[model samples]
Target: MFTEEPSYDVLKTENAFLRARVQELERALEACVPRESAEEQHHVPYRKIFDALPVSLGVYRRDGLSVAMNTTSLELIGGIGDEIIGKFNILEDPSSISAGFVENFQRAAALGKNVTMPPCAYETAGSTLATIDERTVWTETTYVPIKGDAGIEFLVECNIDVTERQKTQKALEEKHALLQALIDNAPMSIFANNLEDRTILVNQRCADAMRLPPEAILGKTPRDLLPEDRAEEYLREDRQVLEKGSGIEWESERVRDGKPYHILMTKFPLRETNGKVYGVCGISMDITQRRRAEADNRRLQEEIIRMQEESLRALSTPLIPIAEGVVVMPLIGSVNGTRAQQVMEALLEGVSRHRASIAILDVTGVTFVDRQVADALIRAAQAVSLLGSNVVLTGVRPEMARTLVEIGADLHGIVVHSTLQSAIQYALMY
Candidate 1:
């Protein structure tokens, strides 16, 4: 009828063209929509698992905008699904911005890789929908980038709360710092060693005394750092302390700066709370000057005592020459056996030195004479007679005469006078 109804071959060509166009449109529509693939379907179950995790997780767009968040992530940000799904921007949100989440996200997106950050404080915004209070918490966050055909598509943020752990770690660090300051600044030499004789700790003074750094001293035994003989002695002493389970104070010699030193060291066993000995601790002080002073004092005192004894001996005996060819020796104080011998020696020496023909022995100053003194006087006279001199004894008081008689001391061959004047007169005449 009208141009053969557009020919059969042309109709078939048009139909085929229409079918191909419809198929092209369907492909475009499928690409435009987020179609689920086998791989994407595998990720679906993992998404559910991630949402149930205790850690906060979120999928952020490459533009730092939140795309989807788990319940934990939503609770961490104190926001609802609608508030965060399409409207939340990490850079614009007060909580995430303060937490530095936006900067971490941008870095992961730009680098198209994972970015991890140290612990940081995350502050919550005051909102009624917030699960947590408006307080700061310590968190360690990591951002992982999701890749697509156009490069990075999204960033997955994972946050871990470490508030309690960080608090405990900070406290321990502060205490350690304080203890280290005390140990370094101590005045005395202090050290600790293990049971195997390995050095565990040493103060600054201890290291300086040993002529080594503190770090160099640790883990080294006394045998490694000290002279061989000294190390052996030190180890023995330390072992005794550990075995005794008590503290001991002893003096030992130490060499430092090319000089010898006397050290007073206090050593004790290092024990645990259960009273098991693990090692030993020691504190030492330099006592070289004090010991030297003590030795010097002893020598000085002995010298003073010797000088005083010499002075006393001189005062106890005196020799006097009263007239020509006459000599007199006077003895005073208690004449014990020792003093009697000294008197005899002095009289004989005086007679010979003066070449006296007559010798007078005086006892006038001798008070409270004993039998020993009487015997000593008689011997003096007899000895003078042997020297070819006339011996005359004087000052024979009644009490001394009684003592001489009681002791059966006979001076028959010796001349006896009542006073020193008589004895001197008689001796000069003879």
Candidate 2:
């Protein structure tokens, strides 16, 4: 009670001074804490990160010491986690690394930068295995300086497994190669075209058939390679397929390198992934030989018909009639210009051979007689009349007579008989 109540002004000054000093210390502490350290700062715990990683991960020191390793990393290295943490030198161990790997790591450490490498096979426990950790094995290995209370403590190493991705990439490459081979060696001329008939893909056979390299035909339409009139026919067919969304097969005649080709073309509508018709796919086969054979067969068929007609006409011509010094010729079947000529020749020869006084021409079975037949008949009668033989034409249908008159057939010196018997009786009576 006697000592404590004396100095109130001093106590107030001391208390204010203490509060100001505390504020100053707090500001100093804030100033002393660095926002970002120039030295490498490991904000995330490396040990915790390594242990938590699903894939194998390891840390290598500058001296090639295995400073830290996860469970998967230790198992892949053929050692327990505790055993490999301080003992394994990934650079010096040939069983775990490829040639020049140590040199590459040393170079990266010296340059204080990242260096990437190609994949290499490593031997582990007398068996060759592919290293899946690209960061530690094949890809870029970064060496960053880690500063701690102990100076330049460790070199942070990361392992990234890229095995599954690499395998998929390799499989894709092989598929691409196989597809290229199939396109190159295809038998027919396979081609792809746009809606405008411009070519997009052409197989080897197509290039060869066009007498050009594959590069020359790319992006070219039939119009670019052929005459405009010819190109229009091809483009028309292609447009039909695209518009109708159907397949078309046709024969195309092409001229390449001054040689003619008969190409059997088949075109189908090409659809996109969304089921929209984008273009057409076409295959063409060389059918020159087959076309030639077909033309030859047609010619032979025509020749056979001509020969058969000649045989029929020859057989149809009657032998020279001997009875009553007269010859009778009966007409049958449809008569055309060619058969008409044959009939006239056969009749004239028969008249000359018989030297008959009367020649009877019958036409009861004749189907139709045109101007050509009427002209041949008139000419034959004139020829027979010149040979001292009177020509009597029987079986004159009313329609045929009108047609003959309309066609201006001259029958001034010819005798017309309605029946064959009437002609024969007239000849015998005369």
Candidate 3:
């Protein structure tokens, strides 16, 4: 009976499985070997099995000369000959010496223990001659010292390339440092507090605002340093953030030295990598100066309004000297109690200042007159009379006279005229 040879696919699958098993053993060996223990002796056939595996491995005598090396190790040395197999000394190699591998191997041999160094730069002559890849390579190397019955026998060296991983880790560290610098020097007050109410982080502005040094602020709760009310308020807001699991923006107030300072504050929930809420992060900016500016603007507006009203009141009740001894007061717009009082005061003041004997009040421009205005006019007439000047009412329409009668305003001693021209003629003739 003839047996069929193994299929190519089956042989390929077997080869792959063997390779995976060898890699697994490599990792297991790395873990099982204690760092402080000398390596136990292995059977001679085991070295040939390790040589068949696809990794760089070699055994070196205590004197640093190569005793045995795998095919992969021979390939890494750039050639296979007496110069590589037995004469190769990693300690004497210029590349290994410069790359720190030689020192690590020496240390392992001296201690009679295993030494592992990760992400170190090591380049082999074979790799440099073969490829156009990076001149510098990164690796995680392991050195294991083998001991025999007599003393130290050999040192096993293993290497694993990790160039990409090292580069990625370096980039992440650089980015984290940049981000930390930005937050540390930010302009606004910023803080992060854990659920236990302990301060985890604070920026320069936050320290300045609290009037405390950074060393004193970190790792402490707000209640430890801030005022009672303020600390309570911060805790309350933090609780809100935790409950909502989201961000909130609001304006708040802080009192210092009996003065109120306004602040715009933003708070949000901080979460862990697993998406669980852990704490609250907050940022605040002082808006006291902005609010003060708004208040000042309001006061300025009120002042402008007051000035405008005064100007209009003066225009509405102008007292003009029409003749040598006669003065005319023209009343316009709807007359109110306040304007009537002003009218009385202005008439008296004009009489005293201009020294006019006759005062004529023209009400033609006045649209409406109330009882308060009629009383005010009578009072103004009485006041002018007391100043030794006579008051004549002119341009009194029929409607105004009816309104005066209806209001029971007694115009007993006051002389009346139908027009301002008639009043002027009467005052000049008198």
Scored by CA lDDT, what does every candidate get?
0.83, 0.76, 0.85
Which digits, one per residue and each the tens of the lDDT, describe model 2 over residues 1-430?
Answer: 5776758899999999999999999999999996766434646675676687766656678778878778766665578867777887867799446555576666666666655445443434542453443323322333454555755545655445555666677789999888767987976889888877789888888898678999999899998987798789778878888777899888878786799889888999988899988788888888899999999999999999999977877777654584756888888777778777777788788877767788888877788888878888788888878888888899988878988899889897789999988988888887
Lowest lDDT block of 10, candidate 1? 127-136
Question: lDDT by residue for model 3 over 1-430, one digit each (tens)?
Answer: 9999999999999999999999999999989986553334433566677878777788888888988778777676566747676888887899889878899999998898899976676555545456534555677889999999967789998876677887788899999889778987886888999999999888878888778888889889989977799899889999999888899999978787899899999999999899998889999888999999999999999999999988887797899998787899988778898899889988988888889999999998888887677778888898889888888998887778887888887676688998999999999998
Which parts of model 3 are misplaced by more than 4 Å? 1-89, 93-99, 111-114, 118-171, 209-216, 222-237, 240-267, 287-295, 320-327, 370-379, 413-430
Ranking under lDDT, best-scoring first?
A: 3, 1, 2
TM-score of each: 0.52, 0.52, 0.64
Using TM-score as the measure, which candidate wins?
3
| Cα shift from native, residue 92, model 2 (Å) | 3.4
- What TM-score number comes out for model 3? 0.64
Q: Candidate 2: give the clashing pairs.
A: none
Give the Å error, residue 108, model 1: 9.7
Q: Is candidate 2 or 3 superior in lDDT?
A: 3
